[model samples]
Target: MTSHYDWRGGREAMMRFGLADAPVVVIAPPPFEEANRLRALMATVARGLARQGLAAVIPDLPGTGESLTDIAATRLADWRDAFAAANEAAGPVRLIASVRAGALFDGGQGAVGHWRLTPQDGSRLLRELVRTRIAGLREDGREASSATLTEIARNDGIELSGHWFTPALFGDLEEAAPLPAHPLRTVRLDGDAQPADHRLAAAPLWRRAEPGNDLELAQLVADDIADWMRTCLGG
Candidate 1:
């Protein structure tokens, strides 16, 4: 359920929870359409964590979810601010974030799913996201005609989920980063060259999902989270 509480002097923080005293964890939702696709997985993680004696807070950062804020008005600073508030309300918690939000670690713990690409690469990824979305919308179905895919990949005004995305959104997403060099066990989803920015360790939680995987990917994520909590807090 949803409840409002004073976070940092009457800021009126709104959040959903599974239970209290379960080693609070904040699960950051993904961006755009993936947010919709991954809602089930996100909730699964939260509930799984709760079952393992961990409290989970899954808040819609400023512009997302049931947040009363507009997406257009949300800035990077605002996101970080919301994170800080969530951390405060939840108390010294480990973050289970998706996409850019995973970059918040202090580079001290093992990061599960995260990436750090340059602005150009990030922009490219955003454009590809736009392209895939447009392709998904066409009557031709998910398998876009090569020509249409190429065209969307190359230019502006590409439709994303039935709406045109301006260059501005891509520009902003490009500059975003989850600063802090937290100790990590990163799962590079795209198979990009490993970076020296964060240490490499085994990350089974974020490996590719097959047609009939043994355990649900979200459950694996939750398991790793519980492991982290145990290691850090003698649970």
Candidate 2:
């Protein structure tokens, strides 16, 4: 069962798979422009976790999704505050995050375990963002390059691809730290295979002009995550 409420000043859209006693896993959604493509998947995964008898709390990042904050004024520290607030309201739990770009914010400190899906380092993600932006502009009949976009957003700000792209924010995205070392449970629902290969071969859904929620793929991801959690922590 899912419910909505406010906690620690952040409005949370939660799905309690079962009960409060059930173990919880705070989900960190993908950050920035790609968030829309992954939000449904995150919610679906929460339902799947609930079916496996776990609770999931998904908090809207400070500057995104139902948040009462301005994206332009928001900084990484604000995101951290919202996440920490979710932690306070969530009680004891684990951390399970999907979408590689958001890995920088997971913190991974107090959780009993970490389950990251499609994790990528910051440098790679930032490079892709730049390329994607430039390509998008070119397609729009405007011959904008990475250097140009970087310069523009770096100077003021630009609204493209549903994000208020900014130079300062891009720098933060570039500086995101890597995940905590292994023995930290991680998985890749898509991308590559090799049992535990975490390399992502497919492009992000957010790149699509009209991103579709592939329910089939979402379900598959949910099932895999639930099974992994059950095995690792037991129901």
lDDT tens digits, residues 121-156, model 2? 666666676777778777888887677766776688
Q: Which tens-of-lDDT digit does each residue in 1-235 have in candidate 1?
A: 6655343223444455556655576655555554565566667777788888777766666656666666655554565667556655654545444433334321223323222211123444465565666656674654665456435434543445433444444445556555653333344423456453332233322222322222366666677666765655544
- My TM-score estimates for the predictions, one after another, are 0.64, 0.79
**Separate clash counts for every candidate:** 12, 1
Cα distance off (Å), candidate 2, residue 81: 3.0
Query: Which is the leading candidate under TM-score?
Result: 2
Q: Which predicted model would earn the best lDDT? A: 2
* Residue 66 lDDT in candidate 1: 64
- Give stretches of model 1 more than 4 Å off: 5-15, 92-96, 99-125, 133-159, 162-168, 188-215
Q: For each candidate in the order shown, give its overall lDDT on alpha carbons.
A: 0.51, 0.64
What shift in Å separates residue 203 of candidate 1 from its native position after superposition? 14
Tell me the lDDT of model 1 at 4.
55
